[model samples]
Target chain A: MSIDVLLQQIVNGLVVGSVYALVALGYTMVYGILQLINFAHGEIVMIGALAALFVTNALIAVGVPPALALVIAILAAMIICAIVGVSVERIAYRPLRTAPRLAPLITAIGVSIFLQQIAILVFGRNYFTFPEIIPKTPMQFGAVIVTPNEIVIFVTSLLLMAGLLFLVNKTKIGTAMRATAEDQKVAGLMGIDINKIIAFTFAIGSGLGAVAGVMVASNYGQAHYFMGFMLGLKAFTAAVMGGIGNLWGAMVGGLILGLVENVGLMFVRGDYKDIFAFVVLVLVLIFRPQGLIGEKVAERA
Target chain B: MSALLENKRNQIIAFVALGIFLLILPFLAGMIGQAWVRILNITLLYVMLALGLNVVVGVAGLLDLGYVAFYAVGAYTWALLASNHFDLSYPFWVLLPLGAFLAALAGLMLGAPVLKLRGDYLAIVTLGFGEIIRILMNNLDKVSLPGSDTVYNLTNGPRGVTGIDGLNFFGFKVRQGIEVFGHQVTGLQLYYFVFLAIAILSVWMVYNLQHSRLGRAWQALREDEIAAKAMGINVRNVKLAAFAFGALTGGLAGGLFAAMQGFVSPESFGLLESVMILAMVVLGGMGHIPGVILGAVLLAAMPEVIRYVADENVQQKVFGLVVIAPEVLRNLIFSLAMILIMLYRPRGLWPSPDRKADTGGSAK
Candidate 1:
């Protein structure tokens, strides 16, 4: 491989990784709070991506500027998916909160399929051309050539992640979130509204996931209803890899997952791209079940 | 009759009624349409698959999200060994056990490494394993020699292996068209009987196992793994048995599926199928054979029923959107059903018979 070739792969990996990190944050946040694996998080991304695709196309058709259209598209998707995320919690998950472990998880799968079907209904089954809002020119940096969209994906994901970090660390709501995640009853006793905190967590996490969906669609240049499955699985793997409940760990895990998957592309075929994240997940769960950055806890009996 | 239903006689009567209903089903299906027969065939397949999976998910209480991996293994085993792809025309009788054996082996292999992991961790690993198998299947068609241009073909990739042998017994081949009892029995109707037999066998086996020592051990494990282990239940062996036996049962479904479809593709075994089957177990009461059968039939048949009613040819419209595409609503209905069921009846539509007592025990 040439110098530029390796750099290009790294750039592609980082771009994809940033989106994976964003999606991972959703999975990690929900998992942290409820010890629930939000299986539909990927579908939220799909819905967001599809919504963005439709809105951007519609806006451009109505003669809106590409940049402004993109902004409106992202915002609409975030709002819709945030509602979707919260609705999923209130309708499917909350009722089964005290139920057996399997109930909510299976319900999550149901919600996933439900969301995908809604996407299919709104947008047809096949891939749609995502409107090219970003300029189509590639920027040359030494031997590496990066596209404008890649920079957008990387910068947007980082800024959002940094914002989230600040929200969780500096804000009172973040402290409440941390407290509830630690112990809901104790947090409730401390005058934190557990329901409100959990709902807020879902909204914020889902909004981030929607943004990732838009980024990934722009990066790939196409949006499909079915695109959520593989990405969702990969993001879930990334969440596990970063330590399930740890926020920053999800970001680190996403970047590493992207790099590893892309770096292995030379040896493996493209179809094997989705397999890399899963393989890492199985290995991490087996050897270091707590994850790379996750603080170890006593095994649940 | 009440007395009969009150004891073993009740089981016999229920079985007889079920037997009669099932026996007349194909004819009724034939009267309705060939498509109906196909639906029954698919439903029976789901029933067997759900039962096989019940051993792992329901009894053992290990939430295996990737149960379809065993189903794929079983299907492929029959596809490769019995199909013309390898020029090996083995009979279905010989291939069935072989297919199931391969799946059981896979289950054991999977069980060995991840059985120690618990809760969501175990669930994620198994899910990953399922995806890995699928990706490998999709990508493992050609292997280029390191420095040479030579390529080795394993599976045919996406196009899939076709022209596989159909179900046969000794020399009596059950092909697409055959006559039996003056009615022209389509191959589908014949397969329905075959599936019914398999479903019964799986039910019988599961029912017996559910009451056996091993079954109690599984029940114990599911209730409290640490307590079971402390009580000398041999958690590892029990867990492995649940995984292996579950795979073996699922393999039967897969083997017959290959024979029925006459083609095997990775697409047939996807994450959706696994989740659908899992939904059947969850929706029907877990660990309850009869309830699972109910779930299997409903889920498998409902989509086809909706497709019929919501046909674009009709004037049906939802929200004035023409309802032209039923695919959109099919998943929506199932998922909606799942969410509603979980919300309203988290113990499932039909709670296990003994679990009725379990609720009070846990409470007290």
Candidate 2:
């Protein structure tokens, strides 16, 4: 009801929105290149979180400093998830490239369930809380209180987004990615290794998902086996909302979805926050199926 | 004998066999205890739900992740009308069709706008629509209904609707209560009612639709939308019809479910339920009626059966030592089954002959 409370909610929304943006990038980028909805992308985020947790736990067991252990965990998660992203493309999706669109989609769903089950099998189903490596202290600026974790989440996500944009527009690998996304056959004919480019795209996307997972775990202070399912759906909605094949659109869309959902919770209940995001998605599809920035890929439909 | 005569004979034999199986199933369940009978009833209800979903995803080639929304509509409709809510007492016959009609209306409303969106976009949009309905149901009390001073206490929010009256016909009750060999039974009667409804409707609709003009149009659309459109098929209308028809069946099933359980809750129709139903359709050959039913029954029964097997703590502990715990093992087995099916029989267990060439578009 108060201005301060509203502002605080907005801040919280933005932080959560940043993570959504990061995960949305994975979806948008993969969809851009392959026109496949990587349903397993959220699971990649989950794997990343677990990877970080395990790595941090291991580092701490070896007497490493808490902050250093956290850093090690992030890097390890990113690298591991990158490998997972690439392998998923190689093994599960490549054979279905020429197959019907539904084949890959089903396969993706299978991979998602497989990964989640594996996670459950490996790690106990109980919600796993990370050691508080980051300080929980809030900075009070005349009634606008922001936690250190929120600042880290927002900054890290923005930096990743900016880095991705730069890589896509300013580098050779990025050019290859864009070319492949435009037309895979033509890109292959033009001396670009389409397979390698796709693998690279997955690696980048999965790495981003990994970073998002870590950020979310750190911010929420807990991670669970099925944590990524709803988040994955919401992030995918964000991707579609921003225009499926466009990267920056995914970022903007994620932030908008997060802001709208958190703000709408003021009028409704917190449990219905997901519904707000979904409603926005439906409205966007009905009115502007091309999404917020419009379709970048001509044959996106 | 003529080919036509032989074909008709084969069909007759198949129908007779199916009828005999259904007739004997309750007797077998009676032998196994009423709980198993109830499980079979729920499984049949799921079969109906999966069959309805098949109309959308398997037939019309629209991936509807929110198909459960229509089910929710049907259940709530029955809940509101049959319960003491609004002091209204509708007869079973009246409420059943009314529920189906309202669910069909919801289908049309949702289908109209997003009919143009294809594939994953359509899927996610539908998913959102499902969520919106759920939220509305949850928040109905907050918003007052038009022309009513009493806030639309229709849903009863999270507490859900309970103590709903069962089906009754002129001086007779279909679910008068369950009955054993010589004793009166309450739950078994509801189970038999639901099971019979599911068996009759699933077989009738699936068979009729597969041989109808509408069925061909659905298959054509599934094969190639552009080609189907070029051939003078109104893609929009056909798609909408698929959605509406599917929602109608879902409504009937939902009503049956509500009547059987005597309760309805928003939680019963969540995204997970949607995914499970979709999985059933996919696991069974999409568009293959029998396959979908099999998929539904297997998926519905697997968890319960696993729980039954792992009921003892010592057995669970021993199983945990040998393999995974029952819960994790159950999910692993299901997921593995899906993966194996995708790899070995990507077309599903009994894929439609027309759909054999179109292997890539399984979900659609």
* Most accurate candidate by lDDT: 1
**Fraction of native contacts, model 2:** 0.48
Local accuracy of candidate 2 as per-residue lDDT tens digits, B1-364: 3465469778798779888988778768878787888888888889889989988888777889888999999899888888876566688788889989999999999999998788778888988888888877776755565678775465888788887766666555666664568876555645686567666767798779967999899888887787788999999999999999999989988888887888888899887788889888877778878788888888899878877764556464765554556676666666666666666666666666555455224331
lDDT of 1: 0.85
Query: Ten consecutive residues with minimal summed lDDT in candidate 1 chain A?
Result: A292-301
**Runs of candidate 1 exceeding 4 Å displacement:** A2-4, A60-64, A299-301, B1-12, B144-149, B176-181, B316-321, B356-364
Q: What would the per-residue lDDT of candidate 1 be over residues B15-65, giving only the tens digit for each residue?
A: 899789989989898999988888888899899999988888888888788
What's the residue-level lDDT of A279 in candidate 2? 76
The collision pairs in model 1 are B4-B10, B5-B10
Show the colliding residue pairs in model 2.
A100-B360, B178-B185, B178-B186, B178-B189
Stretches > 4 Å off in candidate 2: A1-9, A296-301, B1-15, B84-88, B141-152, B176-190, B226-230, B306-323, B356-364
Which prediction has the highest DockQ against the true structure? 1
Q: How many angstroms is the interface RMSD of candidate 2?
A: 2.9
